[model samples]
Target: MFINNTWYVAAWDREVGADGLFSRTIIGVPVLMYRDSEGRLVALEDRCCHRGAPLSVGRREGDCVRCMYHGLKFDPSGACVEAPAQGRIPPQARVRTFPVMERHRWIWIWMGDPERADPGLIPDTQWLDHPDWRSQDGYIHYDVNYLLIADNLLDFSHLPFVHPSTLGGSEDYASISPKVDRLPDGVRITRWTLNTEAPAFAKKVREWAGPVDRWNIYNFTLPGILLMDSGMAPAGAGAQDGKRDGAIEFRGCQALTPETATSTHYFFAHPHNFSIDQPEVTASIHQSVVAAFDEDRDIITAQQRSLSLAPDFKMVPLSIDAALSQFRWVVARRVEQEQQQAAASATGARPAQTAA
Candidate 1:
């Protein structure tokens, strides 16, 4: 089950034009997104109150959307202002408007009660707009459950096998164990591979004279958001001892938004702090990331296809699955808490059991 009382990334900031409307199905709800005349981001249910037509196909008339099917106009608040050929508008002629916020080049929408949507809950992704870093927006659609992608992010062991050439450079990555800490909302994973061969992407940005010390430190938060600090330095440079004097650093921000039960919207960007002047470095880094993600997509898609054949099959876990397992528990616990709260609101009772 999906958690409803949370914010989900709906689209990139550049996806919606000044005078255009963007539509997408988020968590089984079709949503229409656009900017009002005042440049405010607005999100509404794509379905119309009358005749059930999609408002995405309608025309914009000065901050209002006019349904082309029968000329029903709706304001940014989702209220029907004008209904042609009808004397008075019906009381139930308003569509649902969701709370939307545009920050860090990502458009986020509240999928639950509007009153509970706090802007402070959104994660920080300032690296996308920081002057010291250089990066471009990247997106990819996955034909698997968002949780599956989340599992991939929490477990770095797949890097050696799934992305050996692109992201993981040596088999030693699979042998090395990472430190995992469970957080209130998610989990934090820190891994360091000292005196190992540098990954292919790191070699592309700058020439590495020999084997280097690599590190992947990241936080995988609730609702599938990953903020990471990953990089490489020359071997025996005291990188493992927290010395970053001659290291190349990269910041990765990625979001996984569910489009359906078995589909996901992936938004990502990897910004570098070492080469802000050379645009080619940024371009090359983006290209390498795309290639590596393509590898992930292929394997995950196959895994989904196999799982679909046996819906009730239970799998075994290993030591490497600690982070992913804990993350799944966090998601499940949050979903259950939301369900309990909703039931309590309906029946006028307090929830008793708390997830551990």
Candidate 2:
């Protein structure tokens, strides 16, 4: 149910280079990624065209890669430039190349329609590039459908239950309904818990005394990238009015990269405006986030197992599903558009562009 013709984070900036080949599956496509001689990132199909050997096992020669099994060398354009015993290269001796882009210390790859790969389509995440913030990041591999993991994020009501000790405890936090903004390509969900005690993790850097007004805003771009804006200030302060001075604020990002129909890669980074000079602040945020997200992984895995065993079973939505329901609708519409375009192309029906 993954959508093609879009960009997905293939790996973190640190995950792809300064070493041998990086092999991973994105949307069921096995890709071989590495840095070239000029320090450019290149992604090609991992399978060799001839003997079907994994190209990742081969070594790099200048800007191209030489297959270790046979002496076939492929340039960055995916064209086979050299052959061992054969003097002339076969016209079919080429691998598929995926469009790759690096932004915000992450590597993004387009899985389909190389001509339509747009860098502007990549989500806006300027906070990661901001100089005033410090961050900590981590990765997790989940054995579950990517959409299920997205569902958990769109519906934040689980925070109080799943992360009681870390992010939630008050009944009011989970009971608040989110204000949803239906965008052409994504969804924006904002929630406010006024004059409430800050969660355990937030309490570590709370600026004022007593209860503070807390706000959470989530901007989810299509496919699986999220920018979360969260902050807390004095009860009477204008936190919602954008008067964030002397308040505790943090920006968090979460990206889900589908490896297969039933597996995904979770990448996240948390950057905060407060406590920028304290090393311990970053450590605290990272530890609590990891602990909470690990709980998220455990729960999602269990749900995936249950659904796998009972493929026919359907779970009904609850009252708190307003935002998640919208999220599902947006994703479903995009997936349907992709399917229709693919089908039309196969039958030469002149595919129609979907209206946003």
Candidate 3:
């Protein structure tokens, strides 16, 4: 049920270090990642080709991994270099390697054909690495499917009831209307509230004392990435007119990676342009976001449990679900394309792309 022929966030750059090997399951594949002797990262199938052993349990020798169950050794290229007690290595003694790239402080991996993996397809998250911006990175594991969280990001109408204390105000929960657009690759949702009261979290982060103009610009990119640019400015400030000189802007980079059919790994980074040098402000923002996501985790898990018991239950569409429906359509189309390509490849045939 996972999309293979696409790039997905494998891990945050700070997560896998040079000292130890990191093991993760992606799209039902057990993968191992680690830094070689040169401090560069490598991704490969975690299973040993010979004994079905997990290479992650082995020792790291230079840039190669030695299987602990047996004495099989695999190089960074996934080639079996040494096999103890065997005089010669078989031709099939190798593990599969994945195309990996480290950009914007995130390790991205391609689970399909390496030739089709385009680095340009990865969304631009350069702000998280800018010198003048302050960023906080956090992670959460969800028991629900990643699509469920994607639906959550596309629908803000639930904020009033779900995040009443943080992001949702009395009127913003279900009243604020969003303008939705289908991007070439994903969906975009934009909503601007003029001269409105800021919520508790927004007030704490932006230090807005009274009413202010706020904007929520959320872009859901391909596979599963949501880059949200939101902020608040003084009341009567022409924020809609591009006048944000005194405004506090916060950009959040959220990447969702599926661990299994029913589990997901959420990596989120909150970057603010206002507090470039304040450690306390960064810490506060991080805590607030973690709390907010924790709130989401509770609700998503409960929904997942209920859905598991009732798989055929359909979500009744509503006015507020317009954007979410479009988001789901976009994702389903991409997944279908990938599945078709895989089937074609299995039959030794080439698949043609449809014109937009």
The lDDT per prediction is 0.92, 0.86, 0.86
For lDDT, the strongest prediction is 1
Q: How well is each residue in 20-75 modelled by candidate 2, as lDDT tens digits?
A: 78899999989999988767899999988889898988988888888999879999
Residue-level lDDT of model 1, residues 254-337, one tens digit each, is: 999999999999999999998899999999999989999999999999999999999997879999999999999999999999
Put down candidate 3 lDDT per residue, 118-187, tens digits, no spaces.
9988878887898877888788988889988988888887777887887676674377888998897788
| Alpha-carbon shift of residue 309 in model 3 (angstroms) | 0.9
User: How high a TM-score does candidate 1 get?
Assistant: 0.98
**TM-scores of the candidates in the order shown:** 0.98, 0.95, 0.96
In model 3, the clashing pairs are none
Candidate 2 — which pairs collide? none
Task: Give me the displacement of residue 219 in model 3, in angstroms.
Answer: 1.2
Q: Which regions of candidate 3 are displaced past 4 Å?
A: 350-356
The candidate maximizing TM-score is 1
- Candidate 2 yields a Cα-based lDDT of 0.86
